[model samples]
Target: MKKDKPKYKLIIDAAVVVIAENGYHHAQVSKIAKQAGVADGTIYLYFKNKEDILISLFEEKMGQFVQKIRNKMSGTDDAVDQLKVLVESHFQMLADDHHLAIVTQLELRQSNKDIRMRINKVLKEYLVLIDDVLQRGVDSGSLSEDLDIRLARQMVFGTIDEVATSWVISDQKYSITELSPGVHRLLVKGLCK
Candidate 1:
């Protein structure tokens, strides 16, 4: 019900910028409200507290993240093409939204253990998408029949994730999306027959 309100989205988007700039520890609810152009008390109508806002923020953005990747993966025949699309799409999306990258790569990792666990829960959907691609390759005889999909999925996700973190750490000095082809090449070599 609350999500249907315009203020809900306003608060969520505001939280992204606030959390990215201030870090979760220092991002107060009042600041978020001010950024959203709402009363500080209005934030409570949409969220229980700052923690709720943070978790909801992750849930919302990560949900869109997965959906966008899934959309990009659609209508692609070859598993190899699909995999490439996945890498490029992931990089391009993050690169296009630097604030989101900061929120996802940096601030998201700073929460408590329990909160991190919840964040991982959202991340699992994305990992599963990778697994599906690897599984498709194996089934279609494009990838090795003996391929360990679980490990491959982990490696693929790990590579993309580490590269993104490194880019963020390096202040995006280089083109992250431009590295997609090379990253996909390396990943494909390991997956194919």
Candidate 2:
């Protein structure tokens, strides 16, 4: 119910900027509230505490992110084209929002064990999405039938993830989206029969 409210989105969007700038540990609820133009106590009205906010933030953002990627790749029969769409969408999303890129690629890594675990839980859905794409390629013989789906998923996800992390670390010095075609070709070639 709260997720449907305008203020909920405002708070979530505000948390992205505050957390990216301050790091998760230093990103105070008051700071996020101020950024959202809401009272500090209002944060508690929606979230249990700072960790809850962080978890909710990732859940909300990544849920939307994965859904968008799926939507983009839908109706595409070619596995290679699906891979390209995934690569392009992933890079474009971060490139479109630097603050979100920082929050996802950098600050999210600083979370505690429980927080990190929850973050990983959200990430598993994405990993599974990648796996499904790989399975489709195998089923259609676009990729090697004997390909190890697990390792392929790791390679695809790891490559994209490393690229994003490097881009974030470099202060966005270069175009991350420009490398999508190359990344797509490299991964698809390795996966192809």
lDDT of 1 by residue, 133-170 (tens): 99999999988999998999989998999999999989
CA-only RMSD, every prediction: 1.1, 0.8
Tens-place lDDT digits, model 2, residues 94-172: 9999999999998888878888999999999999989999999999999999999999999999999999999999999
Candidate 2 lDDT trough over 10 residues, lowest sum: 71-80
For all predicted structures, in order, the TM-scores are 0.96, 0.98
TM-score of 2: 0.98
Candidate 1 ranges with C-alpha deviation above 4 Å: none
